[model samples]
Target: MKTPTSPIVAPVALLTSAVLLTSAALLTACSSMGGTSQKFDQASVPESVRVPAGHKVAWETTGRGLITYECRDKANAPGMVEWVFVGPQADLWDRAGRKVGTYYGPPATWEAMDGSKVTATQLAVAPAGEGNLPYQLVKANPAMGSGAMQGVTYIQRVALKGGVAPAMACTMAGKGQRQTVGYQADYIFWKS
Candidate 1:
């Protein structure tokens, strides 16, 4: 014995299944493209610079910019000259190649396109290599204005490339001279 099926019921069921399948496919694609479920590996990172447990990555961006250094007298060492870090000026971009924000300051601030911003204190650092800046972990202060930076607890700077101070002599004659060097790094934001 066969029960007759309603024409409307059959089409509705098929449409619902198709929508579900499309959603699932989209989710899978997002994850593969560095979505929320993407895991950040820290196995090769020094223990000192690794993010603490109980936190997960909330955002990730590639920062490409210039780091300025100034030739000045060495602190506490009169007559000795050295390059001192001035600050950084950089643009942040997401994995999708969209420009999202800026990072600049003597206070190390990260600002989002939505006007949300955060300043951080360095927690630890580990050497990356010669001629490269060290990998770093920073503790973020409470975000101001509440957007992308809200609830961010930590920030890790990794995959460093070329931010070291200029190698030219910081002699007395070169005092106060400023040099800007190019750099690129991945900044991973974490939340508890």
Candidate 2:
């Protein structure tokens, strides 16, 4: 026969167990939201990854990954936006086996070394009735029958194992025409 206090102890134990289980569940949910596999945020991005002018990027992943990015502005021009991959330059050797000229390497493969990845693409936009601007500038010589050129569009994609929050910007390329814009995106991934 158990004492009255024994019954009380059993109930207290059951309640404690329930609370611990609930706390564990909550922690798991929060971790999923804050993992590295999630999208990127301006506050979270490193200054080194920002897009530079006249550079095209391509991001890829072998197993799984996620990336978040933003651009100031993107407008279309006359020519198609040319995304390119280049190789390194060869160095000329002097008679003394000295190095000369620049030794450039092939275009870098935008791959994540840590089994993760992210990428962005820019597009073009025109004014009221100007129409869709070309993604690339065909010819920029007024003497050659060209008026003005525009910029390309902006695109960014983030892939992660859990969650992500990414942002990007867009703008027009012209005197007093460029305007900065902001963007946001979310993505998720799961394994079998």
Name the best candidate (by lDDT). 1
For candidate 2, the lDDT comes to 0.28
lDDT of 1 by residue, 1-192 (tens): 999999899999999999999999999987766566345687768899999899998888999999999999999999999999999999999876779999999899999999999999998999999999999999999999979999999999998999999888789999999999999998999999
> Runs in model 1 with CA error above 4 Å?
1-38
Backbone Cα, N, C clashes tallied per candidate:
0, 34
Query: What's every prediction's RMSD, in angstroms?
Result: 4.4, 20.6
lDDT of 2 at 147: 17
Report the lDDT tens digits of candidate 2 across residue range 19-114. Answer: 999999988876664333433342332333233354332211122222222222223654322222222122222222333212123221121123
True-vs-predicted CA distance for residue 13, candidate 2, Å: 0.3
Whole-model lDDT, model 1? 0.92
RMSD of 1: 4.4
